[model samples]
Target: MSSISLPLGGDVRKTRQNSLTLLINRFGVFFMILVLSGVGLIVSPGFFSSTNLLNILNAVSYLGIVAAGIAFVIFCGQYGDMSAPMTMAISGVISVEFMRYGLVPAFLAAMATGLVIGAVNGYIVGKFRANAIIWTLAMNFILEGLVRWSYKGTQIYPDMATEKTYQTGFFLPLLAKLDRHIMDIDLVSRAQAFNGLATTYPLGVPLVLYVMFAVMIIGYIVMSKTTFGNQLRVVGSSYEVGRMSGINATGTVMKAFMMSSLFASIAGIFMTSLNRVGAFYIGQGYDFQAVTAIILGGMSLSGGRGSMIGVFGGVFTLGLISNILTLVGIGTFTQKMITGFLFIVVVAVNARSLRKLGRDYA
Candidate 1:
């Protein structure tokens, strides 16, 4: 029998082609970002302004944090976390109420609240094998009811700036010190430069953005580099296969849920701090937004493959698009319409990619 062989040049060309394919598959989102950013800059002179760019980053910081955390659950092949927004709202409200006790206590309380909710989600999803969508939706409703009943439709605006200043003698300076410590030297310098350019921007942007980025890096490392992340991936890809491999699929899923909730809680605290207020319906639809960002990040709705970098890109993309639309005088309805349309486009692209890959593998 004779076997056909390619020439040396052919082999080199094939390798280059494969490399290009891999690059595109891995960095397609960045390409989209470059295109979008270019368009934004060309169309709106304000788009490239340092102040506007900083505003966009700051605006999207909370969403990025929330989406990063929720990516865990989505990565595990779960439907969605309905209770995330409510958890955020509840935690925010609790933090406001506890502010008088001092920032540390209030922050702890908010995080604890998130942990409790996450535990409940994990127990129900993991131990009881509950339907994630239905259970989380019910949990969200329960949280909503609790908030409504507790607040009686009232909005609590905690003067966090005043409280922090009074407690620390200078909120901005203290926060700046904290920022310098948390963020790397390079980022702190850039943030300081940006702040100098735009006096109206909040200091929280640097601190919160750095924290979110750090969390994403940690999450990525955990998911891609650790045994726990491997187990979760296995469970997401195929529960039966994971079980056959001696992995406790249930336990893994539960842990994912808990982690997701915990992050959601932390995001809630930051959001509340930014607004310095909490209302009964404060976090309405935030869960959907997080899910949208996750999906747009190129994560499989079917689960098992994603990246924190992609999620961050999605968050920034969504935030930038919204800001651009607002700047262009688009109404809320139009913005929602455009967002939904963009989401469909992204998901459709992802689905097509998955189908092609599956066919190739087969």
Candidate 2:
């Protein structure tokens, strides 16, 4: 057979085509966002209002933070941490109970608690090769039982002790400084600073929303721009191959679980602050919600293929959908049905696309 000569610019054309395809794949969530937002705006005049928009952001802040953590586990090629919901609940309770000591101490104790749990999970799944799903699910149940039995269904709150700390002017002022840093405020007056930190800022953006934004940015950088990210990608793509190539597959996975728990602990603190109470049921359904958001963000369940920004988009989209449903007078049960349907569709599409990209999942 005679070999055919290629066109002179064929290589350049192929590169450009590949670049275009990559861009589309990376930002495909935006299309869904636009469509859903358009429908919201058309169906409800209040959908795009500044107040309503801020509400959506505030409502989704904790969920988004947890989703970022979940994305980390997915990136590391693990199924998920079913213990996330109970972890958040317990962390919040621990933080609230320890607040009698001080904010810093409480925060540290809560985070240390999360780290211990994460280490246990990492040791089991990463080191000992335990089944992720079964182990994490069992962990979830154990934590839940512990919380209920320990607290006896009593809710913990920042009581007179927290008030005393707040009145001392030390904690509140420090919190004010933190707000100034997060919001990039220029004013130095204590009143303004305290006001900025304690409640809604600027137009209506909650301080919690700022926390979500910060977490997302940090997560994106860690998962996309760092050497650790590269290792995670390789490990996630093929654990055996990564091991053969001298990558510390087990260590990377352990780090991923730790990071996930750390982030979840932070989310728990925020949730406690927002709700002003800590209970065993505080994070009852968030584990499932975070998983849904992660998958909806276009990350492969098989791992090694997704962007943090996509997960952000997924959280935003879910928030928008929930808000729209509430605005349009939909029932909570009906909304759940819609959300479940959409999740199935997104996962199916993601699986198909991954297959097209030559990724095989057993």
The residue-by-residue lDDT of candidate 2 on 1-362, one tens digit each, is: 23575666454323233565566667777887899899899889878888888888888889998889888888877878888887888788777655644567667978887888888887788878788778988998988888766656556555433323322222333554444442232223422222233265655567778888999999999999999999889988887887789988888888888888888888887676666777777777788788888887778788788889999988998998998889789988898888889878877877776566555662
What is the C-alpha lDDT profile of model 1 across 92-199, one tens digit per residue? 777665554456766787788888888789778876768888999999989888876665565665642332332222122344455444222243333233223212
Q: When superposed on Cα atoms, how far off is each prediction in RMSD?
A: 9.9, 8.5
Q: Name model 1 segments beyond 4 Å from true.
A: 1-22, 159-206, 359-362
For candidate 2, list the clashing residue pairs, or say none.
none
Best candidate (score: TM-score):
2
Best candidate according to lDDT: 2
User: What lDDT score goes with residue 150 in model 2?
Assistant: 64
Provide TM-scores for the models. 0.78, 0.82
